[model samples]
Structure formats: structure tokens, C-alpha cells
Target: MRNDRQPDRPPLTTGAGWHRRRRGLAPWLLIGLYVVIGLAPLAITWLRGHPRQGLAHDLSSGLVMVGFAMMLMQFLLSGRFRDITGRVGADITILFHQLIAWTILAFVLLHPFLYAVPGLWPDPAQAVATLRGMFGSDALRSGGIAWWLLILLVPMAMWRDRLPIRYEIWRLSHGLGAAVIALAGLHHTLTVGTYSADPWLAGFWVVLAGLAVASLVHVYVLKPLRQFRHPYRLVSNREVADRIWEIQVEAERRPAINFAAGQFIWLNLGHSPFRLVEHPFSLSSTPADRPRLAVTVRESGDFTNRIGEIPVGTRAYVDGPYGTFTLARRRASGLAFFAGGVGLGPIIGLLRELVQEQYRGPVHLLYGNRVETQILYRDELEAMGKTLDFRLQLILSEPPEGWRGPAGELTPEVIDACLDGRFPKDWLYFVCGPVPMMESVEATLLARGVPARRIVSERFKYS
Candidate 1:
């Protein structure tokens, strides 16, 4: 690693907005809002002052409203809202969306069960009769529809990969099913809910449902129309590694999206953005690369398999420069990166940014792959070591004969060996890889006394 250090020209802390401490308030604020709205129905119900409907019955109604509120709120947490997602990361928002789905499921399943709770005493037969009577009622038909749809909807989303369905097909079914569920649930609430008779409570449900519909319109209609007006042209797409393609696109017009390195976009190519056809990909070119945006993707998934076939000059729609995994908000004396396989894309882009900025601090990278052929931009990374005080350690879990460098999985020992000895615990770290590997590395960092706030990462897929 060479270090002909020059006077500091670009400060890492220049964009104070990215400061983790500054942005920390957003997640709490969002969580507070979620709690308030989720409980708003219960609050209104209590205030409306209904006669005693028994504790179990009142509890069941409360659960139904909160669950429905959460369902509607799901539209806002769909990773498409920048104002919310900017402070609360896209990954966190999406994961929360998935998590809250299960909670909603619990509430829906328990609502009817709780209604029959009083009869489940000395004789179990009474509970069964209570449930049968409730199910037989014509007024509860909409509730039944929403309940059944929800039962199918949540599991479908959770095990989507295991089921033999295309992503687009699953997505279409998901959206349609959710809409029906919301509408039916709204109908049930407004028509049969004990508290629904109160005008304020009914109006609250209407407002939430309308917002839910507006969110759908914003994503499927409004945003796409905006993208259509400001499209990008595919300038080049070529193979960069074994089954890995690097795509570069230039703004069709004059304005290109400005983003920090390591940020990503939901890329819709050739296909109209109105269709649920886009995929999330990290931007692999430096922010300095301007109107020309680039992404490196592996040959996996339905759409990526044909990445090589996309001809130049094809139109593209980009939905973001999202994610908060960059130096823009962080302050550190040195930097460390851990990337696995295709994870090298954003890490390489960050390195490029550092080189472009002529960063003087020491930088270290640990990139792991199963074989040498899986490595992307081998020569380029080596060349980067010459420009900045950069050290790169290539860890191969399955290396070929005569391999000289460290070769194995990224264990604690391997990490310790690559640390350059002088790097301190406070140096900012970035990790990108398969979920298991990323988790292992993150745990290792935390165990080694790295502050949680000092480690930055982004995940598009969550279990």
C-alpha cells in the first residue's frame, strides 16, 4: 500500500446529514408514529363510550382495529417512500413490513377465537357452538373473506421462493390479494363493528383506507409516470466476471440522479416501470461517474439471466439512489471493507470514490469467494492498492493448487490477519455478502469491540 499523502482536500464529514447520530431520530419518530396510529383506533373506541360488551368482546374488537390499522400502514413501509426510508433504512423498513405481517396474522386469527372465549369454560362444546354461530352469520361474511385471504396472503409472501411461482406472478397476486383484504376488512369494520356506528371511528377507517389506496397509486402509477419523463439509456452492458454482468446507463436527457457510493436503485429496463418488473441493484460506479450509472449483477434470478442480451440504447427507469451505507455520514481515521462474491460491487464502488477523492487514510479490504474465477475486477483492485493506502486480502474458501495467499472462509483468524495491525477498533467497517456471512462478520466485529454504530451495511433480502 502506497501513501504519498497529500494535504486533505475532501473531508469525510462534509455531509453532516449522513451522521448516524443525526439520522437516528428518524427511526424512533417513525416507530412513535406507528404506535400512535396503530393504537388510535383503540383510543377512539374507548372515548366513543360504548356499553359493556364484556371484556373479551371489547378486547377482540380492539385487536381487530389495531390489526387493520397495521395492515394499512404496510403500504407506507414498502421501501418506496424516501422521506420515511431515508432516515429509517430501506432494509429496516422492508424487514419491519415482513415482521408486522406475522403480527397482523396473529391478530386476525385471534379475533374470532377471542369472541368465543367466554364459552370455553367448564364445557368446551359451548365455545364450538359460539364460533359456529358467528361463522354462520351473513353480516360476518366480509370479515370471513378478509380473514381467509389474510391467512393465505401472509404465508404466500413468507415462503414465496419455495412455491413454484415467478416473482412477478407472486407480486401480482400479493398486491391484488392485499387490496381485496383491505377493502373487505374495511367493509366489515364499517358495517358490523360495534364501534363503527360512531361517525368518528368510521371516518378514521375511511381515511386510513384512502391513504392505503393513495400509496398504491403513488407506486404503481405516479412514480412510473415521473420516471417515464426522466428515463435513462443503456450505454453499455458487458460481462465483468464469470456469470456477472456490469451495466452502465446514461441519462436519456440531462439530469442524472445524484447519490453516494454504495447506494442502490430499483432498475426497470426496457419494461415500463408501471409493471412490477424492476429489481433492486447497488450502484457499482462511483458517484463521481455522474449521469452514467452502473450496476454489477450476477447471473441469477429470472431477469438477470438475460442481462447480456439487453442491447445498448434501451430505455431504463431508475427509482432511487437509496440506502445509507456510505462515508457521507461516517467519520473515521481509517476504513475497512468485507465483501463476499457479488458483494464486491458496492465495495469496489466505494473504493473508487475514495480514490477519486484522494483519501489519505489507510483502507483495507477482505473479499471472499469460493474460487478465483468468482473474483471480479482482480487487476483493478490491485491497481487501487497503488493509488491509496489500501490493503486487499483475498480469501478463497476453495482455492486451486499452489495458491499462495490465505485461503479459507472468513473466520476470525483470517480477519485478524488482514487488519494491517495499525488499524484501530474505532475505524468504520462495511460488510456486504450473503446473509449468513454478513451476520458472522458483523458478530465478529461486535465481539472485537467495534461500536455497532461504526459498522454500516445494507440488505435487500431478508428471511
Candidate 2:
């Protein structure tokens, strides 16, 4: 019998499981809260019959700024910032984040009209006149500019694909725009009345300003300073299969951070966090060896495609040891790994960890690629299998001529064949891949009597 205990992975312990009941439905809950919060100001305005005479006058701007901050925090917590935080994958997490962003935009559109307009809201001309009228006065100029900048930037960012800009460049520009908007907002707060005058509102602004500054420091100064103190020089960079690169780094520090098998880190390649362009790669090294680390990365996306160009001997910043997608905490009669495409990064890391730990448990590796040419770390996996006590099975979806391994997709029959009826049903399974492959593999596994609890899958979706 396999041990079914699930100790929470340390990296994922910071409030990740706290919202378990509200995971998928968190957006709806946030929406309900948003509606309530928005309505508070409107209700105040309704009772007072004037904009400046109620709590809404004090709370509206603060609410807007704080709400924006909350939504951004949601993005960070949703795992979209997984590269920096090293938490979970940004799969479904990003979906919730997007929902939050859209919700904020909707509120932003409605906020001004409820307080500024007189029964002419939802009317295009009146809303335009209300916004345009603010720009006429010197006192309201900063607020008008801030509001315009936010309105322009948010929509441009929401429809980034239509914009004539590359993702990497757009990311930098978007960050700059946010800084401008924030600065303008600060100027407006200083010049405006109500919320800007109250000590509590003033304190809230100070705290928000501090948070922004701290986040900047965390990404730039603190993380980089730590890296400088514990220098990790790049030792080897090999071009693995499917144009993926395996980077081996040697840490000079005495007590380097230890990570479990199948974890990942955010690599800051000469770009400051202020630039908003760091990338995440899965650690392909074992945890037993603490002074060194390795990560295999596929050359996809704007940031990842530049990995091939990263010169060796260049210093890199690593912020991680995150992700709960490892095989460390589970006990199973047998272990199975299902990897698709570049999803092999974590699997390779886990295998190396298993070898270092000298795990005698029966383990299996089922990897899939489009073709033989796209199979990454093939020779390395072959060598590792020879030395380690684990079975290896390669599946090619689009195998060319002269291929001898299993062909076609990873169906239930292929899984049964690989496990040799020793699957033990209670065994833990780790799966990593694109959405469709993961769904198919999960469905097939469930059908074959594998309990949902026995399956640990990480889906990596691009936003």
C-alpha cells in the first residue's frame, strides 16, 4: 500500500492552500466583493444627493487605487508571476488573474460616472464631457492626466496582440506607462480634497507607495545583492534536443539554497526586475547537491528564444526553489512521470534527484515529443537510466523513419504497457504538459482506476 500523506511543499505554503475551496471560483467571489465595494460609494452618493458630501468622497479614490493594488496582487498570487515567486505554474492561475483585470476595468469605467455625472451616466457624450471638463482646471489636471493614462494603457495592454509591438518590448513600455500613471496619481492625491486630506487616506497612500518601492527593491536590489554574495558562475551550456538548452551552474557560496526534485527558478538574465522581462526555467539538477544547479529550457517565447544567445561566463540571478510539482512528498509502490514536449524539464530534474537520493523504488519515465528530433536530453536520459534504477519509455507522436520505440500518442494502452500491470493503482503520478495532452492523460489515467488523489499534474499555459 502506498502512503497517502501529502505534506504541503514549503514553497507553496504562503497562502496557496488557504483558498482551496475558492480556487476555480475565486474570480466570481472577487466579483461579488467588487460589486459590493463599488456599490458602497454609489450608495453614499445616493443618500447624500451630492458627490462631495458623503463617505464616497473620501473613499472613492482610495478604493480605486487599493482595488488596483489588490488586482495586481491577485496576478502575483495567481502564479502568473511564478517566475519571480516560484510558486505553481501559471495555468488556470492566469485565467483568474485576467478575470480580475477585466473586473477592475469595468469598475474603472463606472466609478467616475457614479460620482461625477448627474443622471447622464451610460451616455457617451456626458461621460466624455465629464472627463474632458476635468482637464480645464489646473487643480484637476493631474487627476485628469492620471485617469487618461490609466484608461489608455489598460486597453492597449488588454489588446496587446493588436498593438504594433513585440511582447518583450511591450512589457517594458507597459511598465513605464504604469510608473507614469502611478506618479500622476500621486500628484493628484496631493492636490485633491477629501481622501487626500484624511490622515487614514494619507497613510494608505504611504503604505501603497512603500509596497511599490519594496517590490522594486525585492526584484532589483535584494535579489541581485544575494546573488552577488553567493556567486554562481555558469559552468556548462549544452544545446539539448528540440533546441532546448541545458545550463549547469556552479554556486561558490558555502550554503546554497536547496530545492527538491522537479522544482524551478526564475532566471534574471542581465535584465532588472524593473524591466519586467525575467523568465522561468525548470531546475534539472538534483537537490542532494546543493552547491550547484541546472535548468533545462526550451527556446520558445520572446524571452526564452534568447537563451541561445546568452553568452557563457555571464552572471545570472536566480530567484526560486519554488513549485510543489515534485515527487518528494509522496509514497507510492511505483512512480510514473508523463512529460510532453518541453515539459520534460521537471521530469529530468526529478530523475536526477531520484538518482542522487538512491531511491530503490520502481519508477517509470514516459516522455512524448512531436518527433525524434524534438526529443530533449535524449543521450543524458539514456545515460542516467543506465546508472539509475528506473525504467525509461519514449513515445513519439510524430516519429519519422528508422524509429524503434513506441509510436503514436500516449493512450491508455501505452501506459499499461509501460507499467507492466505493476501500476499499483495507489501509485502517485506526476504529469506535466500542454493543456490537451494533460487532459487526455488525466482522463485516461482516471479511467484506468488511478485515483484523482494519486495524480499530480502541472499544466503550463502561456497568457
Candidate 3:
């Protein structure tokens, strides 16, 4: 093994003035706020001291109220707000959003069942009768609308890929469905809620619902307006690897979008920013390459398959610099990067940023691909070792003839062999790839005693 170690590595660049600073609530504080908001209605209702319904009836109301609170919060969580995602990272935020969604689903779905529990014992037929009565009640019409929409919508999101609809259509439907659920649920609550008749409790529901709708307005309306002012023009588009493209857009305004490397952007090319034609792509160019932003997109989806044919100088609008897959707010004595296929997009950006900043830490990359031709930035990666303390390991599962190198999936054996048991406690690990690969790599590192906090990753798809 050829070993090249820089004896005196310089200080970390993350906390320095070089990268854009990200500030948000600590994870504990954020969780605390979430719990408070979700339980606020329950607390307020308890204090109102209404004549208590029996345990089952009260429990049903409580569950629906908390679930409704959480459902409303979902809008803000998905709005891509930096203030919330800054400290904890986008991965944890998104995972939390997803997990809580399932919880909300459970709570809402159980609402009617719990309410019908009272009629279940003596005659099972009575439980069905109770349910039918609840569903058929004219006063509960808004509640019924919300209930049915939840049944149809949540599954649609979970099984989106299985559906025949396009992603844009699904996204629009999801947003509109969420809005309806919020409004209908609110009307149901204020109209028939036990404690919502109180002015203070009704006022709280109104305020929170307003904030929820405002979050949607912020993402769909306000953000698009801002993009119009800070417009960009697509300057170049070219293929970098098999079914992969690198696209660049130059800013038409004064200051470019300030972003940390390893972040991603939602790009809208030759379409109005207000339209639902944009797609998210990882930033392949370093932040130092600003005023001309670039994203590396894979031809995997409907919109991306045609990216290669986009003419140069097309009007482009970007709504990002989103995601926390960067080293901007972290400190690591050494860096280990794992990328599979097109996952290299952000990793390449991080490496380029390190080179531009002259980072002294030892950086090792283990890039995996199915075949040699699928490897991207081959020359650039091979040349990195000459400039920085870098090591490049290209692992191909299906090597061509006369090839003698690491050959396999990025398994535990592959990872251990690549790192050679170095800095398991100190080094920061970045893993980006397919879901299964990332999950397996993350579990492998954890089993090797790498602290969970030291690993960073971002996920766009969730089940």
C-alpha cells in the first residue's frame, strides 16, 4: 500500500469564513418544539374542563387533534425551510417528517374505531352501525371528506412509483390534497369539536392552520417570485458519462445563490418557475465556481431523459442550494467518501471544494459502478491524488477483461479493505447512493463503532 500522510494538517474549513454558515435550532430544541405543537390542543382542551366523555370517546378526540396538529406541521416540514434543516441536517429532518406522517396516519385512522369501541362488545353489529352513523352525519361532512382523502392520498404518496401518474402530477395532487385535508379538518374541528367552541382554542387552530397554508404559499408562490428576480440562463449542457449530464447556468443578476458544496438545487429549464416542471439535481460544481451553478442529473425519470437535448442559453430558474450533505458545518480530521453510480455528483463537488480550499486532511474515496463506462470524472478523480492528500479506489462489479482491482458491491469487506481500519473513531463518513447501498454502508459503519453523528447522507426517496 502506498501511504502518503500530511504530518501537519491545517485547521478545518467548515467553521471558518470560507463556507456559508448555517444556523438552526439544536435537534433537542427542534424535537421539543414539535412535541409542544402536537400536544397543544390536548393541553388546551384538558384545561377547558368540559364534561368528560367516557375514556374511549375522549381518547378518540385526543388522537385526532394531535394527528391533525402533526398533519398541518407536515406542510412546513416539506417546505424546504433552511431554519429547520440547518442544525440537524436534511436527512434526519426528512426521515422525521416521513416517520411522523405514518404516525399521523395511524392516529387518524384509529379515530373512528376508538369512537366505535363503545358499541363493539354486546353486539358487533352495533359497532358497524355507529361507524355508519358517524360517516353519514351531515355535521361530520368535512371530517368525512378529510378521512376519505387521507385514505386515498397517503397511499398514493407511499406507492407513488407504482402509480401510472407522472411525478409532477403526483406532486401537485399531493399538495392540493394536503390543503384540502387541512381546511376540511379545520372546519370539522371548529364546527363540532368539544373544546373548540372556546374562543381561545378556536383561535389557536385558526392561527396554526394559517401558518400551514402560508408555508405552501411560501414554497409555491413566494419562492417562484424570488426566482424571477434572481434569474439564471442555462449556458452549457453536455454528457459526462453514460446516461449522465452536466448542466451549467450563469446568473443573470448580481450575486449568485450562496450555497455550500454537496447541496442540491431544484432546476427549472425553459419553463416558468411557477410551473411544476422543475426537478431536483445535485450540485456538481463547487461553491467557489459561483455565478455559474451546475447540477449533475441522471437520465432516470421522465423529465431527465430529455435533458441532453435542451438547447444552450435556455432561461433557467433555480430554487435551491438546498440540502446539508456538505462539510460546511462539520469538522473532521480525515474524510471518507462512498459514492455509487450517479451519487458521485455531490461527492465530486466536495472534493473540488477541498482542492480549491487546499484542505490538508487525508481524503479517501471509494467509488462503485456496475461497469467501467459508467464511471464519471475518471481523469479528474485519478488526478486528485497529485494535488491533495487523496486516494481513489474504483470498484467495478463487472470488470472488463485483464482487469485486476476491487470487484464487488460496496459490502463490509470492501469498505474495511478500502479504509484499512483507519480513523474509525475520528474520520467523517459520507455515503450517498441507492437506498439499500446507503443503508447497508451506514449499518456497516455503525457496527464498526463509527458514531452515528459522524456519518452524513441525504435521501430523496422514502417509503
Candidate 4:
């Protein structure tokens, strides 16, 4: 039998829950709107009564127009707008951005080639000669430039990690190159496109292109100006575990940025926001500790390795309160958390919130590390167990002698043991860790009768 005790937090049927429901639905609304916009050019071309240039030429023009619309919308998707990513989560947003890029690229690549198909065109040689003329003509220079630039841009982005350039340099070049592509693509469309000669369609392209440029300016200019106004100062930086460092920042004058328990921010230390020196990190502190925020970072990348050397009182900027990995927008009777290595950062913030809210439901935490020394905040977790109806299970892949706790990876059997035959379907499970660990835990939960909706997970890296 279940305890059936109510938690101290508001019920899902309340006003707060309604607000969350609306927020969750907003993403789908935006997506539907985007699809409609992307397909609008086709409808306008039909209404304009443009003469059909056979099936191949018509299809080629349609593909290019739709592809250009999608390419323009890509700027908005990657603009770091909270309204866009707040409900869908940043990981999903970025993944969609990457996947959709390939689709648009395919359309662009096939646009000119489709007309060259021998059976589709009445005169194949004429089609080939037309293509050569278009490519060779100085009047169509913008189109040629856009075509080649896109060919270079997509591959560069896809293989960014394999490149020798620094991440910052690559990021800057990506933005600049994208701007050039958009401008050149716009010029080509207005000059060469048959349907774009229509006033309505021409106006549509101009509006979309203008919006795309505005998005860039917002990200690179306006947002940074806002961040400069409300700066933060580094208060403390300490090595917590093996290579993990706990960083704390305090608001200098303005109030601290309020955020949900499990959200993250792009932290820029000792650098202007325009420098592209920031990195995303999950918050490890709850809102209950307002005006002061903390993030736990592991020494992996170049910037993170020198985290210990950052001087206190250094100026910092944060652009965030992003990601939908928090309980504020979710509802459940009980809660379960699974963390691996530094993935504990957001989980710990959530646990603190649960404790602060006086949540009286069953809670379980299954944390895994490679060794005993790598275990973080062990004493604090133990202390939390005493304050709430919490059970903490620590698992180490390699344990020292005389160790009595669970050993080895968090396999299905180990997870079953951790649950101790208590499987609450109503409980919401949060899993954060390395990609493999998260996948395993999600699969095990689903296999054990947990619904997919009940299992929520967050990935540290999108790629």
C-alpha cells in the first residue's frame, strides 16, 4: 500500500499548474506557425497564376523557395530565445536545428540538378546550357556566391569539432558566414526567382530577411547590452571533488536572475559578452538561496581546466535561466533522481528545492561514480536523507577495500535493488548523466512499467 500523503507544494490542478500547461503548449503553437509560414510561398505562387515551366522546373523552383524560407527561419531557432526553448528544452531545440539544416541543404542542393534530368525537360542540352550560363553570368554572381557559401557552411558546422580552429573562432565565423549567406540568398531570390518578382512574394522575403537580421542583432548586440547592465561578481571557487570545481557568483547591484531549480546559464567570466567566451552550466543552487548562484563544473574543456585560477571579484555575465529540466512545470506524487558524475549539479538543486518546499512524498536518489573519491557532496546527501523521506544509494564502479555499498555500473539489476521492489508509477523520474548512463536508466524505467512521459532526462552536451 502507498502512503498517499500529500506534498506541501501546490497541486497540478492549481493556477501555477495551469500556467505551466500553457507554457508547455506554446512551443507546439510556434512550430505550427513556422510550418505555415514556410509553405506560404507555394500558395502565393499558385494564386499569382505564374506560368508553369514544366514539372521539373516548377518542382525545382518550389524546392528552392521552401528551402530559402526554412533557412531564414533557422536564424530564429538558433537565436537563444527563451520563449522558443523554454518549453521544448534546449537539447531538443538544438537537435531539431541540426536535423532541419540537413533537410534544407538537400533541397538547395537538388534545386538546380532536378532541371537537368533528361526525361523531365524537353531539351536536356538546353537545360544544361542554361545552368552553365547562369553559373557563368556576372548578373547572377550573388546566386553563385550563395550556392557555394552554403555548400561550404553546412559541412563546416557539421564537422566543427574536427576543425583546428578554436570554438570561439568557429562560432564567430559561423554567424558571419550565415549572415552573408542570408543576404546573398535574398539578393539572388529577388533578382532570379520568377515568383519572387510578384510584389507579395518579394515583400514576404524582405520581411523574413529583415527579421533574420534583427535576430542576429538581438543576440549579438541587444542581449549583451542588457547583460552588461546587470553584472555578477565571482565570490568563491573551490575544488569539490577530483576535478570538479564549485563556483559561486553574487549579484553586484541588481537582483539575481531568478530561475527554476534545474535550469542552466551561459556564464562568461572576465570577458565581454561579445567575445563569445561563455559556456553553459547547470545551476547547482536553489532559488531559496537567491541573490547567490552556484554551478559545479568539471575540468574537461580548455576554459574549465583553469577554473581554479579565476580570481574572485572578477566581473561576470550570465545569459540564461533557460532549459525546461525543472519540476516547476511538472507534476507527480513522488520523485526519483538518477545522476552520474558531475550530472549531479542540477539534481542537487532540485533536491534542495524539494526539501525547501517541505515535500513529504517518497524520494529516491541513485548516484553513480567511477570511484569513492569522485563521489560529490556525500555528506550533504546523507544529511538530506535525515530531513526528508529520502533514500540515497551510492554506487561506485571501482570501490576501495572494505566497501559495503553497491559496486559496478547502474545495470537493471542494480536499479531494481536500489528501488527495493518499490515501483511507483505515479512518480516522476529525472535522469541526468553521460549519454550512455541516461539511455540505460531510461530504458530500464520503461521496461519496469514506467510510462515514457513519467521519465524526464537532460543531456549535458547536444552533440
C-alpha local distance difference test of each model = 0.85, 0.64, 0.85, 0.85
TM-score of each: 0.93, 0.74, 0.93, 0.94
Deviating ranges (above 4 Å) for candidate 3: 1-8, 12-19, 120-127
Kindly list the per-residue Cα lDDT of model 1 for residues 257-290, writing each as its tens digit. Answer: 8787888899988988788788999988976788
Residue 358 alpha-carbon offset, candidate 2, angstroms = 3.1
Q: RMSD, model 3, all Cα superposed?
A: 3.4
Q: Candidate 1 or 4, higher TM-score?
A: 4
Cα lDDT of model 3 by residue, 29-87, tens digit? 88898999999988888788777899999999999999999999998787378788777
lDDT per residue as tens, model 2, 1-463: 2454332332221221112221122445645654554354334434545445444434555456555444334423335343432333344455555556666665545556545545254676875676567657788777677677767876777788888888768766665666566667666765673445555545545565555546544655676676666666676777877688888777666565667667667676655444455566777777665677888888777767777777777666676666667664345555789999888888877777666555555678899888898887778788776655578899998888888889977888888888775555656788987778888889988888888878877655545
> Which lDDT tens digits does candidate 4 get at residues 371-439?
998888888999997767899999999999988989998899999999985667768899998999999
CA lDDT for candidate 4: 0.85
Candidate 2's C-alpha runs over 4 A off are: 1-66, 69-96, 121-131, 155-167, 186-194, 252-255, 268-277, 301-311, 328-333, 379-391, 401-404, 412-426, 443-454, 459-461
Clash pairs, candidate 1, are 18-329
lDDT (0-100) at residue 171 of candidate 3? 90
Q: Lowest lDDT 10-mer window, candidate 3?
A: 1-10
> Which pairs of residues clash in candidate 3, taking residues 3 or more apart in a chain or in different chains?
none
Cα RMSD of all models vs. native, in order, equals 3.8, 6.7, 3.4, 3.0
